[model samples]
Target: MLKKSHLLCLCFSSTLLSGVAIAQNAVIVNGKAIPKTQLDKLVQKSGQPDNPQVRDQAREMLVTRELIIQEADKRGVIQKESVREQLEQSRVGVLVAAVFEDYVEKEGVTEAELKATYESMKSQYSGKEYHVEHILVEKESDAKAIIAQIKSGGNFEDIAKAKSKDPGSAPNGGDLGYVNEKSLVPEFSKAMVQLKNGQVSD
Candidate 1:
């Protein structure tokens, strides 16, 4: 049977919902106290504004969840592999979060520490950026022919705009403006770095 406090928490404040308050600080469910902190989190997660309708809905949901959980525990349904694994995941997730919280609280981040960390991994934030142009084709033979044409005095942009298959850059004459070297594929970046200004890749 649902406790008086449980009904109160699950129902609207009005008598129409059969609500009966028993505790001022917590929702009592099957003689177990569900703390206000945990209850607030549950309500917040419901994504409902703090109004009578949402409050009542959140309460009903929490009550139903508790009842189902209690029934499952009593009947050993939680012992099944799937249920156990689900519960284990929840437990581990909570514990992991708690550990991170505790560690951060104990050894708080300082501006100096942040700067030091940033400096240590500055390569991630700082790199050689490049402006590039390329002709993309479906076949290697097409690429080789295109490269030969460029070598023989074809305008790279005109050729790229006419024949490059990469729709995004093709319209813009294959102009890839100020690319960070690290963002490109390894082989592409290697080839690109070998070229001087306004030089086309072979």
Candidate 2:
């Protein structure tokens, strides 16, 4: 027969053992302890057997998260003003994104407007085309001489291939590919725009 104190100790030990057993049997993922039923629900939601690779990945992510939490605990980061401010900012960003998405869904561009816009910009979408030849020289006089030769019926492409100072374009007879208005320097673009088909510019 046990004394009252011994009986009390036995009850306490039993309670502690039960708690340890519960903890040992629990499944923790990403810092949250989940019951077996909950894990089964998750597997059902995923519509597949929680494969070994997937379980390993989940365990790895949980371990990494625990490490981060432990380090943050040691550093007392949760109480920092910057952390609070960043959390608030993130909440504000979420709210803003939700509002913007709602606005877009409610007021999306009309089909008519889209078609009109496409028609208006159709000519601007010309396919890749290049029919340009140029000669570059260190001296402006040499450039002018080459332009004069081109004007006097000399083949500009041939002359550029033989005489242009720009090594990259010279090898290709100075034939740079189709460039839009924004692709060249302002002065170069202005000069190119003024040229007609087969015309040479100074």
RMSD of each: 14.6, 20.8
Top candidate when judged by lDDT against the true structure:
1
Error of 1 at 138 (Å): 1.2
Please report, in order, the local distance difference test score of every candidate based on alpha carbons.
0.76, 0.65
Cα miss at 2, model 2 (Å)? 99
Give each model a TM-score.
0.42, 0.36
Tens-place lDDT per residue, model 1, 1-202, is 3565674333222122223442332355676555556657767888877776776676666667777777777778888886788789999999999998897899887899889989876865488888898878999999999999999999999998999998778888998878877778999989999999988777
**Model 2, residue 26: displacement in angstroms?**
50
Q: What's the number of clashes in each of the models?
A: 0, 0
Model 2 ranges with Cα > 4 A deviation: 1-130
